[model samples]
Target: MTTTTPTPPAPTPPAPAPPRRGRALDSASSFLRRRPRLRLGLLLSAPMLWLGLAYLGALAALFATAFWHTDSFTGQVVREWTLENFRTLFTDEVYRTITLRTIGIAALVTLIDAVLAFPMAFVMAKFCSPRAQRILVIAVMTPLWASYLVKAYSWRVMLSGNGVIDWLLAPFGLDSPGYGLLATVLTLSYLWLPYMILPIYAGLERLPASLLDAAGDLGARPWRAFRSVVLPLTFPAIVAGSIFTFSLSLGDYISVRIVGGANQMLGNVVYDNIGAANNLPFAATVATVPVVIMLGYLAAVRRTGALDNL
Candidate 1:
């Protein structure tokens, strides 16, 4: 009887109450939930303020500065507004030459990068297995981790008269192009090649294999299918990549300085004006050319529906 009398089950301990702050937090969260737009506005306010101040506001100031003239004697940015900087940019043959040369180099670099990236990207996206694709992607991206200056200097050495490239080609009676526009173009193409490859790879990877198969089935040869299906589909990616290459090259002064020898691009002009010549107004005016060019380019491509695709 004693054994059969079971001890009263111990009363279960009451659950610990939630902390007061947790309840306050829940209430706050509930408040935010009730006004999503306010929450969103609060969230966006910081970034919008930063973007306005650091970017748009700076750009507006720069545009304003471009309209002003510099005081030569004091080498100070004069607040007086004038179109003289723009008139000089337009009328000066040196500016015209530099502008054209810069454009040519940018275009050449973009063309080179696009040509080189497509085959590699296509092979990676279409032909390679997932593991192989990953390896290739890693290979393409590895160089990007290296300093841009390091790569430019490396190319400078390679293109030097007795450097790696010339040493290799010496026996073959071939020589490096040496330091000039060609060198600048090559260095830019090499630097920006990964940018070109990544976008085209993403675009090609997104393309359905069935479309390519259907093209092949419909009496299209390999080149024809690529020309009709692949190129059209990938054009937006090409444009996207070109934007990086072209804009980077357009604004680049460092690489040219490192490897360009006597050559000077638009960027050099801007730099010289800002530093050597002490002409901030002229420098700002020169800087606006690339901005205007990029804007015009975007506008032109907007009609192609490519801007949206990017």
Candidate 2:
């Protein structure tokens, strides 16, 4: 009797209920579901718009034009499709020489830019005060605001057979100094210097000073600390700067045309093909090589998550 009374007295309590969805979340979910068509359309259209308007349409038109034959006698493209245009590029040793020279120059310029940019970037990051840093940044980026054509032309004058440089250095036994590859590379370097410095500098600036301090605390000297800690941390920046230098140098026809002496690059070839040879399609094809190569590198960067900050 006592146990039965106690059991009956143990009153039951109401259970808590689960929370309902908020109006905002519910509305969002509903909107997402109802707007599937719009979302899908956006997804599908973005790439088409980019490719159709930016690249494929122009490329198709250019390729179509390449089919037209270039008349060697008239130095004009005849309105007929022919393989002769493509064959001429491959057969002629002049085009081959030009292509190779362009590649070599681009490589050399990239190497020089990398080596030159790194030290400057490091100095700016590790030594300079914030005010000094700002001034230096402005100095590095100042050239970009100037006319690229004017700069190249100025370089041409500077590097001419007898230019102002020779005049300035006559007492020191130096000549117009812009005489050859040295002048071309120097001018190209000057032109694209900012592209290299900015990224590398940004990368170095991002490096944690604590890492360097920690390396030093562990008995590592400054150089060893930089090699082990700073270098790895800034690798992505170096690679990015290298890419900019390489790609820009590779496509620079103006610099080469103005001051390269006999050293022609891919850009000049493309220019020559467009006007002198009248072979737009082959030039487009040649142009596509750099695009594809750079895109592939970008893809690799994305895959590695190295471009996350950029």
Candidate 3:
């Protein structure tokens, strides 16, 4: 009877179920269960999309302008795509000289800002009380709310040959009037100084007092402690501040034009192309340089996380 029943085949274990045709749905559900990337993507989609479009539009407009040439007869930007204006800029020695002068002057202003801002920031961070720190921060940043154009014009009133310094020095033999690169650089440096100081102060504020204490414990002099510990820690903010000063100087059409005499930067060249020269394409092309440089700098600053302190 056992043989006849074939020993009643041991109960077959049920075969495992195969993955279904709706595999994506199962996968998606599984992803949702594990990762929040989908939620992040949904949240960020709008702003990312908008920013991409805006940058694309700006570049497109600039490139389009670059290709259009200025008509010699009418001084108007004609639709004809050409490189004559850029070529002319390269060939003209006078424009080249002005360009170099602009770069040199801007660099000088940035250097001056760096030299003066570091110690001031270090002092504020390590020494000043929290209340004093708050006041210092306000004092540094308050200048920014003032109109930039007004500030630049204020230099005109001060740096003119008969301005404040000259008036003071008039008591001595120095009666010469001075309104040129020297005056321009000085004014620009003072105007942009606060922008550098605030970032640096903020960086200093974040430094751990423990590090300075360690430096002191190790027999390092106060200056050595600052140089090795404090300065090194705050380097990112210096870079950040320098980047700001550089970019601001780069686009400083208003200040230079107001005070720079015959010295014209790339900004002036671009402005002239659009307004005085009436060549949109050349203006667009010239303007593209600063925008690109600014974007690259902004990206660099973001990577450093220095602006986070601000």
Among these predictions, the greatest lDDT belongs to 1
Relative to the true structure, candidate 1 reaches a TM of 0.91
On TM-score, the candidate that comes out on top is 1
RMSD of 3: 14.0
- Order of all candidates by lDDT, from best down to worst? 1, 3, 2
**lDDT tens string, model 3, 96-152?**
675666667768888999999988887888789999988888888888889988988
Give all TM-scores, in the order shown: 0.91, 0.74, 0.78
Query: Candidate 2: minimum summed lDDT over ten consecutive residues — where?
Result: 14-23
lDDT at 22, model 3: 66
Candidate 1, residues 1-310, lDDT tens digits: the string is 3567675567567647767869988778889999999999999999999997778999999999999988878887889989999999999999999999999999999999999999999999999999999999999889888999999999998898889999898899999989887888889999999988988898898899999999999999999999999999989888887888888999999999988989999999999998989898899999999999988988777766565545
Candidate 2 per-residue lDDT, tens place, 152-262, comes to 899888767678777788889877766466777888887777788888899889988888889999999988987889888887887777677777877888887788777
Off by over 4 Å in 1: 1-18, 22-24, 303-310
Please say which candidate is ahead in lDDT: 1 or 3.
Answer: 1
The count of backbone overlaps in candidate 1 is 0
